[model samples]
Target: MIVSNPKQKITAVIPIRRGSQRVKDKNLRPFGDTCLMELKIRTLMQVPEIDEIIVNTNSEDAIRIVNECYAVGGVKTYRREEYYASSECSGSEFFRNLGEVTDTDVFMYCPCTSPFVKPETISQCIRAYAERGENDCVSTVSQIKEFLWLDGKPLNYDPSNAPNSQDLPDMVALNFGVTVIGRQDLINNRNIIGKNPRFVVTSDIEAIDIDTPLDFYIAEQIYRKTVIEKLELLE
Candidate 1:
């Protein structure tokens, strides 16, 4: 049976799908003796700030796995329609209706792609959001420290007068590691981040998002070295 914590107020909705053409079973694929799907639940379960977790996916395997092992951890699966997870689905209407899946006033859209998001980041952001009233949303971002280009133009640096990489102004991209937004704002605007958003800065390592075969390989190695091996040392 599913569980809900009325006092916490904020719900965590994780949207993942069965069809992964790039990495193939990306979420369920093995990593450090566990998969991304398992690790994500394990990570969120550790955070006291997140009381309820709804895994919104169209995968039967995913639903069964969560219900069997993770339901007790306040994790449950929402049976998303197959069409909505398809490529033909309309981005605007489909995303807007996602907020309707649950009635929480506020929710955190947790992406399963980002595997290394720290519990401290999520907990701190939630506390910050609760304290700040002026900001409408709290979302994670990673600063673009690399030299960027748009067409032929230098986006953040000059070619000939090359300045030190550290000297460049802050340019950030949505890392989608931790995103908290109002339910009404998502339904009304058909957006994740609102007009006024509070950005939570994450490190490049934490911002590793898996979308391709190469990404899976890279993240798997990193997780093993930085996480699994370290844990083994203690044992």
Candidate 2:
């Protein structure tokens, strides 16, 4: 049962698969006390600008858990096919399917691995896309100053220059936490990034994603230390 919000027109699509090569049961694994997907749902639910959220997965346990504990009126689940559950399955395919079902003007692609993604960032991406008017896709990015290389060779070609990180022109990389895409571009191009892609720069703190056991541990610690304190104050 997906809740319909007439105020906002954006739809959020979260594609979660059962197969995880690095960490077993990654989506269902507990972060603090709640499962990863549950926390992701909680985060999405808090955003006023998100009209609806759909979970695309095939795992029986995941469906059961989400249905029992996380099935809100605005959140719906889609059963993915075995073919789409493969390790080679492209996320773009899921996004395409979701686009067909919702027909939303703005499609937000959020990953369940990033539990700490704030609603503010989600709203920010939405506003950025709408205001830009010409953007086909918008994604969060972090500026990096570290030495980069390709094929065992330096990329910047200046080994001697150790300029202050702040002084150097920022190089941005997709953070993959939150992506806002226009429906028309995705349909026309079959990709997130169309001809005009917007990059929203974000802080490193909002970019922590859980991929391995170590990553989970670090996220858990960070949540307990910082988010917990903030929540306690709200209480």
Candidate 3:
């Protein structure tokens, strides 16, 4: 069947929370010369397809950091309510409110935790959404190795597990590092994945989301190994 791509406008939502369960003031935590939140804001602002970069945050410090770092004038702010501020608050609620305020054909959601997003990744997801006419899309990754799962019962290990990692069957997993949702679907369904969802493939590095102090430290190490070394060469 001949296929036609859907073309739609895109907006970005970067959500930040004041209360961090793992690390204290994690968003404000330093990453080289800038804070973690600032790094994400700056990175998202660089994407040309992003029509608007909205910061859905409850922290005034986070708001101030974005104002100071990002040059994107279309940046909008959403003050998360107390009920919605808790960790219990579903991400869909944030999108629901965002959908109500903004006017865009497609919606993109990024968490403050993942700071090393590339402009190309954003563009690719945007292209996928527009071309495929999918209701929603999220950054995903594939694992080629089998894993052992131990529930409350006995071990659930594969009997014929291969010694080599590359020999195992690949498993594709959603990264939630960069999620894109169609405007109407996000609004009506109040979900990132509405009726139809697409998976936008991305690298493991791009999918690394900081959930704990150790995760943050690992990100820092990766950044130093990859980014800092390059900056040094530019000099």
Whole-model lDDT for model 1 versus the true structure?
0.83
Query: By descending lDDT, how would the candidates be arranged?
Result: 1, 2, 3
Global local distance difference test of model 2: 0.76
Q: What is candidate 2's TM-score against the reference?
A: 0.86
TM-score to true structure, per model = 0.91, 0.86, 0.83
lDDT of 3: 0.71
Tell me the tens digit of each residue's lDDT in model 1 across 46-94: 8887768989999999999999999877788899987878888887666
Best by TM-score: 1
Error of 3 at 30 (Å): 0.8
Task: List the candidate 1 regions with Cα displacement exceeding 4 Å.
Answer: 1-8, 158-160
What's the residue-level lDDT of 115 in candidate 3?
73
> What is the alpha-carbon RMSD of candidate 2 to the true structure?
3.6
lDDT of 2 at 118: 87
Which whole-number lDDT from 0 to 100 does residue 139 have in model 2? 90
Per-candidate Cα RMSD to the true structure, in Å, reads 3.3, 3.6, 3.7
Ranking by TM-score, best first? 1, 2, 3
